[model samples]
Target: MSQLIAPHGGHLVDLLVPEAERDALKHEAAGLPGWDLSPRQLCDLELLMTGAFSPLQGFLGRADYESVCRDLRLADGQLWPMPITLDVSSEFADKVAGAPRIALRDPEGVTLAVLEIADRWQPDREAEAQAVFGTTDRLHAGVSWLLDKAGPVYLGGRIRGLTLPPHYDFRHLRLTPREVRAQFDKRGWRRVVAFQTRNPMHRAHLELTFRAAQIAEANLLIHPSVGMTKPGDIDHYTRVRCYEKLIAHYPEQTSMLSLLHLAMRMGGPREALWHAIIRKNHGCSHFIVGRDHAGPGNGADGQPFYGPYEAQELVALHQQELGIQMVPFQEMLYVQERAQYAPADEIRPGETVLNISGTELRRRLHEGLDIPEWFTYPEVVSELRRTHPARHKQGFTVFFTGLSGAGKSTLANALMVRLLELGTRPVTLLDGDVVRKHLSSELGFSREHRNLNVQRIGFVASEITKNGGIAICAPIAPYAEARRQVREMIAQYGLFVETHIATPLEVCEERDRKGLYALARAGKLKEFTGISDPYETPESPELRIDTSEMNPDEAVQRIVLKLESLGLIRPRD
Candidate 1:
């Protein structure tokens, strides 16, 4: 295991930051809206400061030195790929394995450090090569020595694990009018519209987007987010493929495609402005704004952070300022008979309508129910089916609802291993403890905070399920209403199975892993669930296996059966 360095002296293999530049780095990051780097991130920043990864350095140096400055217009330079970040745990593994290089730095024609591409790492040779880097007199002793001795020490900072937004060359950002106009001239279309969504393409959404294009008398650019979108949202690979399928429906030689690898800040109004700014950068004259653009979560009483029109209105407010036009519409509700998208303003009263949400659409697809072309095109459905074959590939919310000491996490890990072997579909397990550690780091264990805590996990799990993946959640999810809210969110994805591991309070109290239950009984703890807070187990869950009565294996077996019976898990593919 790669050791986590505490606050102390630096080790080798470390990215060293001069004290002079540390404040400057933090200041630059702080200048960005809604950005905060953690302590470990500060250490990582040294890599950028030390010239290990100067994403914009090359663009700034040679390009500017050799050529006279162009009128800082759109022709300033060509576009380049956005900066990239590798997940910490994933990168740690790659470093230990000595993964093959996907890209490398060259200084004065001399090779420097190389990096492995996150998605494509052929582990065999690298894994063998990594042996010399570990401890003892092993071949990897040099690497081990560097890691132990040269790594930077944590000096008490924030977000020690989070990655940073990339610093890219501004010169290589915008799409020149010359290029875009050239394409427009080829296609015989003057005006162009862009459709941007961090979602899988649904019929209602397509109707809205395509209608915007048609209304603008322009071709469509189905641009999707391929970066750090909402956590638990469909991964870009599936969403991108889904877009490819739907784009096939557009008239040939008219529409185009692109991907935006931008991370979401979860800032509502500011997010709209940012989206408009980016769309402008991509040579889009106009953008489609939906209600609550990029809303991260709800507010005080389960209401969304902003009203539906608030995001759109924010764009409308800044439309001229940002140099982009906005097409804002109410949330599109599907009309079956018309079988296409229509403005909510145009729909007549008394039309028999099914208010199918992205959630319901996901539910139907996950349960193996056939979807009509009216709701979603055959091509898109085919793509979804490829990932989640209706009946055979059901996503799951493996909820572990028990007291703290009831061994929920242990069983969860074992279940994860078993499901990994069955690996026909992706699985994400959200343990309460783990979620608390990673996501709700700022919150404490207050009752209100507990709700917020589970809400975040539910949101993530819901995203996973929406994108055709399994979610295994194990929280007390104590309040029935809170649990219901989570269910409603995951319901958007269709495969929401709540497995309540009902162990008796006495059993849980006796096995208090944290001794909190014991303290609660001894009057040392207050507001503890099952003692003061009361946990209402699912009265009507899909599966209610009593772990106190049945063994873990038997409980898991029963849970699997419930899955099979519900058409979530099926005969071997």
Candidate 2:
């Protein structure tokens, strides 16, 4: 008697082996070639096994991969908007070549599944990126990961799950597709409308979702992605706590909260269609499709990649085939006169509307400014504040990059002493020579080695910033691209201040305290920066100091002023 939509491809495709067969599968997998799945791959496999990614029994083989990329459909004409492929290094591909099966394990060495190999091939990644994401530009996060981080080869086959990946936290709230459908059945909820979100909900979200469900005459499913989202998104732990608090405000028996482990691609319009199919698999009769659903904010050009209404339009185009009704997200605003949320289009002509954008909300949290009760719940704000303290109270990094002997070390040492004098936080100095002596004793001046050294420094600084400490790093990070990589790595947790010690190269050579520039000029040093090798200057740094014209104290004072202006540190009394 339920009117819920059927799973994609007509059945819930659960590949998890029955209890009777798991023991044998595990035993057989021990002898097969093994691959430790990455975090994103593990999330994909979990959904495939649990029927959350229904119709995808395994990673796509060559034929299916090509088909999905060229068009958002399987070879058999089933609509699937995304391609799920398991990529591996060339060494693994050669080892698994012509093998009947391979074992997949987690980082802890626990065998989770076995893949019955069907096909192995190297994909034209550029083509895939263009067709699937509409661009091959590295500025897009997904495209960047695809080009730089992913492996060279892909393996595709059917998967036999021996055990589901273990999640110790929020175990009760993590429901499989079957379990959620069963819950709906138990509640006699024949009509269920699912709302997908990756961010914390405010009053506007509650109003929009409630109105959506009310219009559809269905129960509400508050499903949130707990896996990897945008790089700087709120951590799942904090977002989940916020969800737990917000759900209390909903009417009992009308709404349910469930967590999903989905590594989102931020694919914009295509992602909207994929999400609709997923909700259909979860036994929902309706799904909410909003403006900019699943969109990665902007491209490198600082323009929106997809039109604001594109996602809604794309879902509407395919909802009939997808079998899930689309409930468009209503733009709700708090009417000041009535003090209640009303659809933007339906408000009276003279009525005032109040809204809080995500940027404003973050600004309020960062500056420790008051967030109005009309915008967000007090409990939710408290949970956010616990994770994101005020900007001045939070930890940050000060990175100094310039040519060798450009007074970077002196300025960094002076700044470290000044921070230590404040006696507010732990301060650590990572000078180039000191770090080379300790951390990079084995690394040489090759481009690859230099990149590795900078990455190691970025990782250490990120940890320090994450734990509420100050890290002052001074290095001749010559390549602009490498410096950008470090900036991206550290920006996820805290502010990354790139201070360019813009002393002229001639002045740096004239100082030559270590006499390295002399050796380079005499052709004694190979691949020496600014001599034999190229040094790409930063296009725009947070602070640029001309150490040739100013002493170390003045340079440090300039940096301190920059940090204070950005609210990273308090002004000295």
Candidate 3:
């Protein structure tokens, strides 16, 4: 008999068919209707097929879904915190209705599995948000996804996996639960502790994990999520490189590193319990539950979605039932007097402690500031620097929004010329008229079409920013929501500066350079901004200029000054 603990619920559930049966299923799937899996669905499917989410045969049926949402348990009374459902668009749901089975395809159109449909329903997203994440506010990233990004309908069924998703990068470290358990048995690791993290591991994290392992007297498993985490997080490629460098610091043979392709919901306490269950299934006896584990930061009210110790408390409450012990993460601090690290509660008062927060570290990286050796390894810092270069060396986007005839194009031209004069980086100007003619020639001025056009521009701008080039965009982006979406898209790669040309409608009409306002006033043009259509003003922008009071050159100078202050450009000597 194996010395390691048994899989959750007495056995691991493997959805993949036997090797002998794969050929038959593959042939049958070709004639069936197919649903392309989204990124989150893909992650869930992988875990389901690999037995990481043991006892879950496939997507949750309506009964289990409602039970999981309301009571954090399945209809069978199993301890399942998160709901695992396959959401789909309404059109796909209708097409697949009453079908015996449907193929599940990846983005590349390769069928990975066949789902035998059992139930379908439209989820009450608001209720699910309140029950699971404790909030329905869009400021929460998970809530935003539920409300805005998720499909309208959910389909539940049993999945017959043909093959796991192909991962070309880091294949060795991506071990399934069964493979991980086999390794544990082979190494005779009786008791193992799992540390789950989505962020890059630094000195504090290293110390925390080391101490956790020592306290539990167990082998350490440094398992980080490589799938979709919170937005604006460091890319997994960079994070994995950092993890590889940090692992060498641990005692040889005491630690192992693995990657979990988990699409995190950032549900705080509930997510903590779910993680503990997952680790238990992976042959771990102890799991780390940190302060604000899986938290999605603050809400729209500027208050944290979950308390600091809520996750730890929740995990501890179900420790025995989960078949895994909860290891509470203690905040580590560097002591200047002793030149060593100590836990927060163990440190003496006024001993000159030092710590760097994630925000502070990001600021340092953004400004090319130094990150001391005590905070992280030099190799990790080098990898971070390669991805997040100094602000002046990085690409950025400057977006100007205002009413038509507000001198946006004029100011954009002047700013473009000024930036070109510096000759430090290649600059691309995407004026409203120019984009309308070339990129969005088929698009109309309808709300949907306009938003689509703006999103297309945002996509292009994001690409430019990602490639270390500057993009200057000038458009009558009257809707705040569309502009906000553009800002988010650009911000993921580099800096996004929103400049509001706050020129009044009357002043814009007085200029009337394009005769657009005249046409709108004469009722020749319909659905025109500042006439028939509303121009939702920006609540807060990086810079706001009213051309009625400022000239083009002066406005451009102010923008340049703002960029310099933001460290995107160096000041003249």
Residue 202 alpha-carbon offset, candidate 1, angstroms? 3.4
Candidate 2 lDDT by residue in tens digits, 80-161:
9898989999998998788989999999999999999998889888988898888887777778878877898999999998
**Model 2 residue-pair collision total:** 0
CA lDDT of every candidate: 0.57, 0.88, 0.91
Tell me the TM-score of each prediction against the true structure: 0.50, 0.94, 0.95
Q: Pick the candidate with the highest lDDT.
A: 3
Which residue pairs collide, candidate 2?
none
Which pairs of residues have clashing backbones in candidate 3?
Answer: none
**Model 2 vs truth, CA RMSD:** 2.8
Q: Which whole-number lDDT from 0 to 100 does residue 168 have in model 2?
A: 98
Runs of candidate 3 with Cα error greater than 4 angstroms are 1-10
**TM-score of model 1 relative to the true fold?**
0.50
**Candidate RMSDs in order:** 17.1, 2.8, 2.5
- Candidate 1: C-alpha lDDT: 0.57
Clashes (candidate 1): 16
